[model samples]
Target: MKNVYIETYGCALNKADTFIMETLLEKEGYKFVEKPEDADIIILNTCVVRLETEERMKQRIKELNKFSSNKKFIVAGCMSSAEPATVLSIAPNASLVGPQAVERILEVIKSSERKIILDGDKASVTPRLFEGKIAIIPLADGCAGNCSFCITKLARRKLRSYPLREIVESAKYAVLNGAKEIELTGQDTAAYGLDLGGTIRLPDVVSKVAEIDGDFMIRIGMMTPEQAMRILDDLIEVLKNPKVYKFIHLPVQSGDDRVLKLMNRKYTVDEYRQIVTEIRNKIPFVNITTDIIIGHPGEDEEAFNNTILLMKELRFERVHLAMYSIRPNTKSASLPQIPDSIKKKRMHIANKVYEDVAYSVHNEYVGTISRVITTELGRKGSVIGRTINYIPVVIKNENAQLGKWYNVKITEASFYDLRGVLV
Candidate 1:
């Protein structure tokens, strides 16, 4: 068996793609290698979320180039397609593949040639590449929206939904294989099935997965406010299933209307607030998380203040904060760029606010018994799991096993995660 090494970047979707590639290549008698230097083939699954990420991908490629001068190098995922010319410029000798072209990995590897592979081949494999005690499944590729700062739109061109039957089957296979945590991922998970013209919807998919009686938890991925609003009622109904985790991650980007407009976001701050309010009203103890871009173009002090005020008001359980970075070919790239120093300052302030709010809010959860799915059994027998509300809970028990749902009593709480003992 020829040794192959793969390094992945970006979101869970990319991780899932890497797993698929690993499985496919392994079936064809390829052995997984840890280091690039020891492998005959090297794969870099790159990310193109921001300009810095793209640059980091190039840097990694350069470093790998030094290690495996005689090996076949393959670059795939968002960066390969988003900036094909740039990626090729960096490593003209390497083979490039896109997110949609993952199904062709076997053929590309067998060809023994250096060429760009960007086929939008539909994934036909029934079992996922990396099904474990916990699994992540991408329900779709590409996105329905074209946010100004997003280069993923260029990489993942169109929204392509996996057949509902195939997705449900995959979910069942994961569970049968002892998976207790199944994360349904995509560019915009809530926008699933819209590309199939009302044949099915996100709620229908969730309902099907929930019906597959497994002692596992399903996490529906991030939803855009626009998609959530479109199917808010349906989503609420689907979430009523106990099998689905009581959590929703919606990337609001910014809470200021001016900043929202400047970023080409479709929803207003009021609309986002209302969605959050409505979700909380219907679902008890529902954990809401969001993404925030701290210093976007034209995001003045007043706009930034609006964002802070709104986040304080909403008190999200977690906020994935990132200082806006310009990406090539993005509409926001040409706008008045915020200085790095100013962006860092805004991000620091936002971090402090989030810490204060999160700690204060989490303090109320002390002395509560929560059900958590242990995903990682850390060093010294400490198990780190996520509660039904998606808060990380660290359990100091030696007998804990990964992927088992346990009743953890919250004894202590922190701004970032919860400390609990598994009973």
Candidate 2:
């Protein structure tokens, strides 16, 4: 196909997959189009994170199937590999490619008959998701965690850390390409470098990139508690660099020890909090964001209350809350599931608790002047800027320029963000 149209979904890893597809097709003289109506090849990079997400992906696939008679349509990404039968049942005529098989996109595009390439890891493809604004570097693929509820582990099979030099070079390439923000991401960032000999770890990677001689800032991605504990001292050292954003994302999942044990999480609540305490003691301005699953199986009422208490004690800058929904073939799926009503109730309570703490923390920013980097345009005609600590500040003016720093006076605050006006 001469023209390709790709719609990416899911996490940064999937976006990086689309970037690989774009880079490969461009080398063969293929043109990318904005809309599917104007393209010869249509590809939908699907996500299967939640049952609801799969349903949404199915709807999108059906809409794109109408173009299959004229266009060479394909279904790619996590769902292609994890739920191959489900995808084929919906669009049997379309070619299928897995998340790991991104490099073979051109092969599927060239074949006339239905092609399916969903075997294993294709380490040859190094994703450079530089969309002119930010450059996302996938330091590795897969993870070393054995969490009971994660279906992503099935889609992305193993821990394959890319070479340290190559990963560092990708960061250099991004900065040279005018990207102001460099994100070091992987399935489990703290677990990086274990597949490579034990010499290099994530701290080594971040330190090398920080020395790349650029005005860019680095943001490290999510780290499982067990792995983050392994490299806390070293991680803290690299994060001290001015090039790194004063932020950390640690997905503790649940706060109760009973729930954590049933979920097969390696770290305890105290262990997770110690990591948070250390980061706060060393870098007080660092914003810590976390994830919490409200209603996992085996979470008793006492366990649920413990989580609420933890939230009040920690008061994370942002809490990504989710209701536990069982995914097929996962360890937790076989266990007794909490009722949907219970999960929904827990999610609502957790959200209310989250908003209470979030608003209180954000109110501290009001009536203060701070410098922020204008990053993206908000959906409401304002420009979104972020402080050094990564707290989003909405400069309520449409004419603000991006990629530049502006001094703003904080006028108001919400649980979501800070609203400011140019000083």
TM-score of every candidate relative to the true structure? 0.96, 0.96
What residue runs in model 2 are displaced by over 4 Å at the alpha carbon?
120-122
Model 1 misplaced regions, further than 4 Å: none
lDDT for 172 (candidate 2): 83
How far is 417's C-alpha from truth in model 2 (Å)? Answer: 1.0
The candidate that wins on lDDT is 2
Q: Which ten residues in a row have the lowest lDDT in candidate 2?
A: 120-129
Give me candidate 1's TM-score against the actual structure.
Answer: 0.96
Give a tens-digit lDDT track for model 1, residues 1-423: 789999999999898888778768877888988888889888999998977887799899888776546888899999888889988887888898998888788877888577787767665553465544668887888878989998889888888888889889888888888888888888899888887896788998989988897788889998899989999998998787888888999999998998899888889999999999899999978999999998999999999999999889999888899989999998999999989999999999999999999998888878999888888766677989988777889999988888887898999988999988977
List clash counts for every candidate, in order: 0, 0
What C-alpha lDDT do the candidate models reach, one value each? 0.86, 0.87
lDDT of 2 by residue, 1-423 (tens): 478899999988788778778878887888989999999999999999888998999999999998999999899988888888888888889899987778898889999888999755536666554785577888777888878998888788888777887778778888887777788888889998887776899999898989998677888988898999999999998888888889898998998998999999999999999999999899988899999998999998899999999999999999999888888789999999889998888899999999999999999999999888876778778988888888999998866887778899999999999999998
